[model samples]
Target: MKVLLYAEATRLISKSGIGTAYRHQIEALSRVGVDFTQDWEDVYDIAHVNTVGPGAKNVVRHCKNKGIPVIWHVHTTPEDIKNSFVFSNFYAKLSRRSLTRKYAQADHLIFPTQYTESVIRRHGVKVPGTVISNGVDTQIFRQNLCKAREFRERFSLNGPIVLGVGFPFKRKGIQDFVEVASKMKDVTFIWFGAKILALLPKDIRRILRDPPQNMIFPGFIPQEELIGAYSAADIFFFPSYEENEGIVVLEALSCECPVVVRDIPVYKGWLENGVNCLKGRSNDEFEQIIRTLLKDRDLSEKIATNGRMVALERDLSVIGDSLLKTYEAVLGRCRS
Candidate 1:
């Protein structure tokens, strides 16, 4: 079946999880022999809209009017939007109402996590939806010793490295990351992600300007280099307050890097504390987890190994099959 994969503002979200998800979806759908098009004008059997912007809403409306099946992908919610960037919190309430209206136009909905689906339901989005992860390309994110060594040398990094990857936003737990780094002055703390200087909040901007001695903000490295960073790091620490689904955690797992993430609902079934990953409830807990992982090589290796297995289960190939099935099911309902 032909599918129109639509996501407004692709360039704007290119460095974001949404953009990465779109790219991975396109690759996976193609591999599974699903004919798809990004062009709005192209004739297609279904519309898989990923964003809820003006253009996206128009597409959803157009598809409904044309009797075409529309699958809306839920990548954001009001709960996750607050404190994400400048003015995000201010606009979050309105976004919820807007999102509810837009999602209502879909024939079916897709959520990256069950927790996200629950959030939407709480916000009064009653549309039928299912949970599906934004899978990672294991080959691209897996360990690369050569690249890792080169990356460490290029950045002059020494000693154990704790890393995080995401945009420099307050909701991403940037302040907490900095606080953790200050306590662990012996280890190198590198954050690889975009830094939108103009849009940063005052407190975040101040912290960026006068970062801790051990903290390194290598803003926006290439994907290959990012993969290397994951391989080089002894531990991947993500203290984000929220996420629809933390794709970077999966990528770090693919690289066999032991991950320590905030104990959030989104990662309920995805990450198991003390099994595939370590979950921290606060900055103190995060620091303690990092220290434990640093001192215990066997535990780190065991977690990394198990994490890789988890990553494999959510590989692009597996996700593609799930997407195909979901599409067929949606179409069947439409016909009925």
Candidate 2:
């Protein structure tokens, strides 16, 4: 099928999960040899969009004018707007609401998670939508590409490493991540996140400005180098307060790294605590669990093995078929 996929920023090609998802979806279609473009004369059969802003809005208008099918992939929620955009700019939530109306008007709705579907549903903007969990390149990430000792020396990493990923923002519960790092004395805490300087409160900004001796912040790493980062860590730690299916969790699992994720509903569905992954709800629990996992190498390895198995079966090629089915369903509905 012909598709015109539009996104907010292709910069996500180098950083962050939403950008990563956009890149993956386009790549998946490209691998299957689908036609897509901006212009209408050579016209697209479907126009797939991501975030609800200038690009998505403009793409939808163009596609609708040409009588082509349109799909709005809802990757961000209302809460993300409050956290990422200031009051002045967050007025786009109103525009975002209008975009949800576009979803209601579109030939189809594409969402990364059911949680996202539920959010838009609650907003009284109901239309046909399907859930496609974010994807991972399982085969590429499963192997250990970097030698541990030399890699550790290059980055000056010391002790059992605990990694904190996702953008550094309040919604990511970064303060909670910092609290976890502060409590753990022996482990070196590492953060690979975006620089959200303007959004943070003053003290939180200063505390993270220099970062502590124990805390390591690698500003931004491209998608190509992320596997090396995962290979370097003993466990991937994420405690996001708000996540519509954390794709980084899948990426970490793809690397055969054990994970400690928040006990959020979306994560709870895929990750079985203490069996396939470790999960926590409270700060005390998050700390104790991290310490216990650090000491238990055998348990961690077993969990990592299970997590890799899960990522392969759930997040890779299997998801491609599921996505295809969703597209087919949308097309079928449109025919009626």
Clashes found in each candidate (C-alpha, N, C closer than 3 A): 0, 0
lDDT string, candidate 1, 184-300, tens digits? 989999988888988889999898888999999878999988888999999999999989988999999999999999998988977899999999998999999999999999999
lDDT at position 136, candidate 1: 94
**What C-alpha lDDT values do all the predictions have?**
0.91, 0.74
lDDT of 2 by residue, 81-149 (tens): 555424523654665667556677677787777777877788787677888877887877764756445
Q: What is the lDDT of residue 147 in candidate 2?
A: 49
Off by over 4 Å in 2: 12-14, 38-42, 85-96, 145-147
Q: After superposition, how far is residue 297 of candidate 1 from its true place, in Å?
A: 0.3
Report lDDT (Cα) of residue 23, candidate 2.
69
